[model samples]
Target: MKLALFADGHVGTQIADWLLQHYADDLCLVVTTQENSITEAAKQHDVPAVAFRSEQQVLDFAGTRSIAPDLGILAWWPQLIRQAFLDFPRHGFINTHPSLLPFNRGKHYNFWAIVEKAPFGVTLHMVEQGVDNGDIVAQRQIAYDWEDNGESLFHRAQSTMLDLFRETYPKIRSLQFARTPQDLSKGSFHHSSELEPASQVFLKQTYQAEELLNRLRARTFDEHPSCWFEADGTKYEVRINIRKADS
Candidate 1:
């Protein structure tokens, strides 16, 4: 099985390591967002590694190959994968997205799930032209509590995503997984730019208590910028921590 891995971050590194160990001969190329562990592992094994900046680069590389890869895996990939690259992989690419597909299709899935009070989960799906609009290969719906802030949900989703990938590997290898086309109408889509505007707490505008809490908690990832409000000439960031009172 000739394979190409387009990956990033911890899950990406883990995938690369597993492939290098179990399917070294089958791996043709490793495409990473930057010089990370994925590239480093590929380097150690002398596998071809590239940080592709454009769709044309991927096309050119595929053109050089006599036979396209059997499959490609996109784990935590950042950019939108174009059709040219999608077509190069024989069985098409499978993406490990953090959100339950169709819903929260683009960026900030963790944050949106909380803000919108939508279904929160992880999905492994076939990569189509659109952002996370793909046939579902596998999915795991996660339930979040009021205690689940953006940071908690983010880590939880990542953990679940990796687990789903591991459990689904055998099916993927055998090409036995089902591709159920997502119902495009049922879920929501968001852009990366939408997050900032959504995160703005309007100081003057009245909001329901629940609505205000949801907005604050959704953006409450301590590692990143939190929800903010403008006061006079200055801006103030706010975050919340929810816990049950002990009896």
Candidate 2:
């Protein structure tokens, strides 16, 4: 089956490369949000790359395109596609999301997962009119170690997602797979850029020491902002390096 891939950032490189390698014969219409490794990597593979200046522009480009997509897979695409572009694909759009669906279905999910001390994993789901709320195609639990930080956890998800994709692709191609409906009661909706470090920390959602450390280690990456907390009118951002104590 033909697949259209949308991706950006470093995770995009891993996902795009895996797709190109596994589906060498599959035609992929690559959509990108910026000039990044995903774009460069797609170019290296000789795949057609369409760069959009903004999310709205993405919709416009999809509107102009005559070719219809069988399956659309989003790999770290910074821009959100509207329903029009989403409907272009007969199967709608699928995203390699970082959080477990019907729960952590929003931005900064990893952070929230660690903060909430919930199991972290990947969700390959159909993108609906709502955010990450479509029916779930497949999911896998992401493992973590005592010393694993956000960067490590992210790479773990990347590799895990690739494996899940390979195993689920045939099912998707045959259109024989069933999607589990998400329970709206367990669903969470996080707004974009909702909370910064300086934002007031409501005790209800705040974590203790080790829990906070675990959260910090599991969320912030080299590109995303680092986690920070304040005490006694002084604010301190988490800076976990190669060497650190468990405590």
Highest lDDT model number: 1
Q: Which stretches of model 2 miss by more than 4 angstroms? A: 35-47, 54-66, 145-148, 197-225, 229-235, 240-247
Root mean square deviation (Cα) for candidate 2: 4.2
lDDT, candidate 1, 144-190, per-residue tens: 89888999989998889888988898888778899999999998998
Give the lDDT of residue 166 in candidate 2: 78
Error of 2 at 131 (Å): 1.0
What is the lDDT of every predicted structure here? 0.86, 0.71
lDDT at residue 148 of model 1 (Cα atoms)? 85
TM-score, candidate number 2: 0.77
* Residue-level lDDT for 156 in candidate 2: 77
Clashing pairs in 1: none
